[model samples]
Structure formats: C-alpha cells, structure tokens
Target: MEQDLLPKLKETSVLIMDNATFHKGKRLQELIRCAGHYIVWLPKYSPDLNPIEKMWSRVKMIRNKFRVKDIDKLFKDYCNDLFGI
Candidate 1:
C-alpha cells in the first residue's frame, strides 16, 4: 500500500486510518516521513470520524436487495444495479 501511494503523494499530504495493529511499523513510518506525508489516526471509538463507515452502511442496505449466492452472478448484478449498466 505504501509503495503504491508514495509516488502519488506530494508535500503536505496526509493518510488517515484507524489505530489498528496492522497499521504500525518502524519501516512504514520511515517510508511515510521520507515521502513528506503525515498520518492521522482516528480516535478510539470514534466511528463518526470514519467516512468509510457510512459508505459501508449504504452497501449493506444494497446487499439486502440481492438474493443470489453465486459470486460471479452477484458481481455482475452488483455492477449493473450500482452503475445502471
């Protein structure tokens, strides 16, 4: 993730994520700092600060509209329903 985002990040860029165990390491910190970016970890128990949480809520509501269990069919259905294709 760091490798891909590093080239695209410029000065004053910030990356945001929750304080999960997988998000930390000395190497990762060095890499981010070298790229002139910053990390802003979300506060504990603050779901409102996470925008992706709201997107997931909308996705779960859409999931209820589909009954198909087949992965391939579900992929096509999801694209069609979401994109009107």
Candidate 2:
C-alpha cells in the first residue's frame, strides 16, 4: 500500500479503511500521515459502511455457485469468467 497506492493518491486525501491489523501498524499510519493524507477507520463490525465488503460477498457468492474441486483452477476460472482475465 505504501509503495503503490499511497504514491498515486492526491495530497490531503482522507483514506477510509477497516480496522484490519495491518492497517493499524505504526509504520503504515506514519507513512500515510507523512504523505499528507489522513486515515479514518470504520467502526468495528460495520461491514455495511465498507463498500468492499459487498464486492467480497459477491465474489464469494460466485465462487460458491461454481463449487469447483480445485481451488487454484477455480480462481483462474473465476477471474477469467468475471473479468475476462
């Protein structure tokens, strides 16, 4: 995130993220602050406020619908089918 996403963002941006352990790291927070952006963590257990959760739910739903035996193969197929990867 520091190497990629942080550099692409405009200055003084507000980053809204969930309370993931990795996101709470001192280094990550310092990096964000140093980059002239702010981090706002979503409330615990508030998946509804996190838009990515809905996308994850959709991905899981699609994966379950396929029910393939091989996970690696299923992931490849899932990406191809969904994203034309």
Candidate 3:
C-alpha cells in the first residue's frame, strides 16, 4: 500500500488519519513529511465525529435486513444501502 501511495505524493495534500497507533509509526511519519503535507489526526474515542461511522452503521443495518447467501452479494447490498441512506 505504501508503494502504491508513494507515486501519488505529488498530487496529495493534507492527510487525515485517525488516532491509530499503527498509523503513528516512524516510517509513516517520515513518508508523510517527505510528501510535504500536513497530517491531521482525528481525536481519539470519537466515532461520532467520523462521518464514515454513520455510513458503516447504516450498512450493517441493511445487511441484517437481507438474508444474503453469498459474501459478495452482502457486501454489494450493504454498499448500495449505505449510498442510498
């Protein structure tokens, strides 16, 4: 993933990352600095502040509504419902 992202550094600007310990690695920090972008870290223990969490909750609700036999179909249905919500 890092290799894939390295080439896009020129086009990248600010990086928004959650308060995850793994994302705070030295190598990651170096990479972010080398890309010449500011790293905006979100507050810890604040899922309500993250818009993606809302979409995920909606997806879960939609997935539970249907009796999907295949994992791929369930994922597709969840994404569709999320977008609809």
Give the top-scoring candidate (TM-score). Answer: 2
Best by lDDT: 2
Cα TM-score per model: 0.64, 0.75, 0.63
How large is the C-alpha RMSD of every model relative to the true structure?
Answer: 3.2, 3.1, 3.3
For candidate 2, the per-residue lDDT at 46 reads 99
Per-residue alpha-carbon lDDT of model 2 for 3-74, expressed as tens digits?
799889966799998998998999999999999998898999999999999878876776788887787977
The residue-level lDDT of candidate 3 at 54 comes to 85
Candidate 3 clash pair list: none
Identify the runs in model 1 with alpha carbons over 4 angstroms from their true place.
60-79
Model 3 poorest ten-residue lDDT run: 76-85
Candidate 3 lDDT by residue in tens digits, 1-85: 2688666777667877877788889889888777776788889989887788887787677677997878798888886775752
Per-residue lDDT of candidate 1, residues 21-77 (tens digit): 777877887788777888888998888999988766655665667877776766676
